[model samples]
Target: MSLRAVSMGAAYHTAGRVPGPFYRLAPVVAWTVWNLNPAWRRRLTRTMLPLCEGDRARARRAARRALQHVLEYYLDLVTLPRRDMSRFERDHLEIFHNERLDLLRSNGPVLLVSAHTGNAEMAIQALTFRGRSFVALVERLEPRDWAEYMLRLRSSAGGTFLEANFAGVRSCIEALRRGGVVGVMGDRDIQHTGVCTSFFGRRVRLPRGPWELARRTGATVIPIFSSRKRGDQFRVYVEEPFVVEESEDAERDIRAAVERYVVLLERHLRRDPGQWAVLEDFWKVHACGEG
Candidate 1:
């Protein structure tokens, strides 16, 4: 069991933002098999939420069903050919297809804050199909082969990948000023100076880059996501722009803004825990005083 678990972990960790659809689809295929089988799904469900109340077996069953529903859509993403993805866009138009229409249709820059809850790749694809102006911030992939492949894939989605570093910020700011949107995910703390906030009822580090950039640029802060829905479709949720509240204590005010973002992230994750793909001790470093 330990070997099998470690092997899966290694595989996922090594596949950092692989751009090709095949590379991304491989794991989804494995996950779908794991999810389709009732017994296996129930076992994983129980292991994931052992702390939940009620009869362990019954609780696991309900959670298993919910996960199955989520996985069904993930499977569709892999199995179905997305040819003329334009058609799929129209079918789900109600799901925020028009929320950023003006910004995308125009030449001005915008900031999009996303989290790691569902298949974010689909959201990026949707933006590209609609001629959205945006660049996505992500950690640079190591190894020459991997980096080259990922950049190609990301470019197909209309995103210019800015490596996570000081220089990347300059590029991101440029994109915003050029009437393009900059996309960043805030759920995980990749920066040493990230603001600490509560998540899942416990304090953890949250990235402050988006809020800081928004304040500096006077650009809109939009929270956008594409979560899996029934029947292999996606529900694109777009919250109104977030304004950074000013205060005498700027540092404290920044932390406060981050806390609010964390709260919304927690609520969304709680609504669909299976959508979260985290497997490590997410709060471990914080709890140990290392963060």
Candidate 2:
């Protein structure tokens, strides 16, 4: 058995057994320990420097908050399977501009590009509470059992979960072909293969799956995001939705759509960098080359 599997399983069970106050304070402790790690501090500071507008102290503060929120995200994710969907949605989740979600129910195929920011799972669960069912393309965690645990928990709310892979790509295309709603994480290039584009004024690679699926199926691509206001309070942002024009130049259309998605993501990050839950050094390659 992998160490990650043991740790994840233990955490899930322990988190469920702990008292509410200690469960709530777990993030503070987690982030405090995270900040004590020199490598983690560097990663957080590097990420926050630009997002915090170059204020070192402010960036550090934001970075700390961001780390805390990240731990909260994992905690919520693990314990979600035990939550009462209706009570959770009523007491914790708040959707801003929710009317925008109507696109998911329309006759046409819908593609939502999301980020690691905030509790995206919370947004997904809330949508399920409203009787909305969609396919969420999630990264497959290592140690197969861990991935299975994630899929089971996420799909417990009636939403579909597909691993981001070649087979998953086929499934996504099929879903869109049936005019289904599909969501993909737009910020991270998990597969390493991506479309190079400008984000935060620096060149970065973003996943090509969403744009490709949209182009092939003529699906409407919407740039949506979620942010943790505090505790269980979350905001799901639905911005401009557009279709990729199938012009003579396929690559151009995809790249242009990517640029638009990048703009929306940058706008969200600027509002509060701490909402971004990805703790890894995201920009492993930046400003390397033009698309």
Q: Relative to the true structure, how large is the alpha-carbon lDDT of every model?
A: 0.60, 0.78
TM-score of each: 0.70, 0.91
Candidate 2, residues 107-223: lDDT per residue as tens digits? 888888889888876676666555556788888787798788778877876678889988888888888898887888888888877888877766778977788889999999877
**Which candidate comes out best when scored by TM-score?**
2
lDDT tens per residue, model 1, 1-291: 354344333443443223245344644564676667766565555534622333466445445544554444333333323234456566643465455545656565577788765656556556666777567777665564555544554554345776778888888887777667788887767766787765655556778888887766766777776566544456777766666766577787678768778766766665666565443345554432432
Model 2 clash number: 0
* Candidate 2: segments with Cα more than 4 A from true spot: 17-19, 285-287
Candidate maximizing lDDT: 2
In candidate 1, stretches whose alpha carbon ends up further than 4 angstroms from where it belongs are 1-85, 91-108, 230-232, 246-248, 285-291
Quality of model 1 by C-alpha lDDT: 0.60
Candidate 1 residue pairs in clash (backbone atoms < 3 Å)? 107-179, 108-179, 109-179, 109-180
